[model samples]
Target: MFALMQSARLESLHLSVDPVTGLKAVIAIHNSQFGPALGGCRYLAYPDDESAINDAIRLAQDMSYKAVLAGLAAGGGQSVIMRAPHVESRAALFEAFGRCVEQLDGRYITAIDSGTSTADMDCIAQYTQHVTSTTAAGDPSPHAAMGVFAGIRSTASWRLGSDNLEGLRVAIQGLGKVGFALAEQLHAAGAELLVSDTDAGKVRLAMEQLGAHPIAPEALLSTPCDILAPCGLGGVLNWHSVAQLRCSAVAGCANNQLTNLQVGDQLERRGILYAPDYVINSGGLIFMALTHQGAQPEAINQQLLRISERLTGIYAHAQAEKRSPARVSDELAKKMLYGE
Candidate 1:
């Protein structure tokens, strides 16, 4: 565990367990040069404690990069609550997790992430004032979707020599809150949508409302399209998948899209324009960070608009250096976070 933290540059890790509620949690804090580490609390079933701890550490590191590139004065942290069959009472479990967060004082702030919702954040807020994305704070998914839409436009302009989405095919792999919202925006922009999700209900809703053609989840990645938007889980772009990609560009709101830095190199070699995941999918973090600082709505929107500019800058640097954008992004973020 100490070796993992060292490799990831994690500053601290907090573990807590509540036998009564079957609550087991790991909170990993990475970097604090800017300010308190801010990230989401993920609740999901993990095969083992090591997997949970590793996920928290990896996500916390990504959050640090996301926060730095988004120009926020915050670090990165992530907490994961291991879902077990023994866990009963969701509310009680989250409440216990909240107390765990409070124990960190102001070192870390929690929000909603995968397998967690605004209501879960509300439960966390009960124990610590250091939480966001509560029901009262409003959902950040739509704002994140909007940023991704803008990013796609930027990517189209850079790669396709035009910003027009009309008549272009986009394959989206995920139909959750953010993904569905992004599909609506893309549909309105006249982009042809090919969507897939684990939930048949979500796929049906997109097909009915947005006229999206449904693709099987397993086949979405290799489907021919102008772009591939992975709104699902991370590590979606690995060796096997990258070799089969048929798109000109890959951009989405998913964090840690590439399995490792080497996969980014593969994308570059394949002549695919890869938008760094953290740089492009930072709208939610921007919203949560600014909201926590009491910034107005307009201020938040302005920062969101900067997402495209940041991506374009990264693309340009990558092009000039003949390096993958993901590599350039990591270098730039490291410079900001550690002055390395």
Candidate 2:
């Protein structure tokens, strides 16, 4: 655990275990230089404690980058609740997890992430004031999708010589709330859509509702398209997958899409303009952080547009320096977080 913290440059790691509720949670705080650390709570089944710890650490790091780039007064942190086979009461488990967050005294603020929902955050809110994404805060998926949509326009302008997504073939993987919402915006913009999801129901709905062409999950990456949006899990673009990509660019709402930093170099070598995940998918973070801080609705929307502005700058810097945008983004985020 100490080694992991040291390697990741984490500020601290807090653990909570409730024997009765079977709540084994890890909250990794990556940095608090900007303000109180804020990130989403992920409740998913992990193969082991190590995987859970790694996920918390990696996501917390990215949250730091996301918050800094979005100019939010928050640092980076993440909480992961390892899901067991069954729990007698879901609310009870989350309430216990909320209490665990309360114990931190506001050092880490939790919201909804993968495998968690607004209802789950409502349960967490019942026990602590350090939680967001309640019913009142609203779902952040659409806001995140909107940010990605704007970033895609900027990407198209840089890579395809046009900011118009109209008639562009966009291949989207995953059909979760963010993915489907992004598809909706893309379809409305007159972009041809090729969508894939593990849930056949979501794929069918996209086909019927959005006129999206359904592709097999295994075939989405290699299928030729203008842009590939990965709205699913991270590590989806590794060495092998990058080698098989047939798109001009990659921009999505997934966190940590690259398996490692080296994959950024691979994308650069392949002439694929890779928008750094944290830079492009920061809208959800912007909404969750600002909403929790009581920012007005218009302020949040204005902040969302900064996603495109930041990406545009990053892309320009990458082109001028002959470097990957991912690397440039990391450097900028590090300078903000560490004064490096």
Candidate number achieving the greatest lDDT relative to the actual structure:
2
RMSD (CA, Å), each prediction = 0.8, 0.7
Off by more than 4 A, model 1 = none
The sequence of per-residue lDDT tens digits that candidate 2 reaches over residues 269-290 is 9999999999999999999999
Q: List the residue pairs that clash in candidate 1.
A: none
Runs of candidate 2 with Cα error greater than 4 angstroms are none
Which ten contiguous residues of candidate 2 have the minimum total lDDT? 132-141
- The digit string of per-residue lDDT tens for model 1 on 313-338 reads 99999999999999999999999888
TM-score of each: 0.99, 0.99
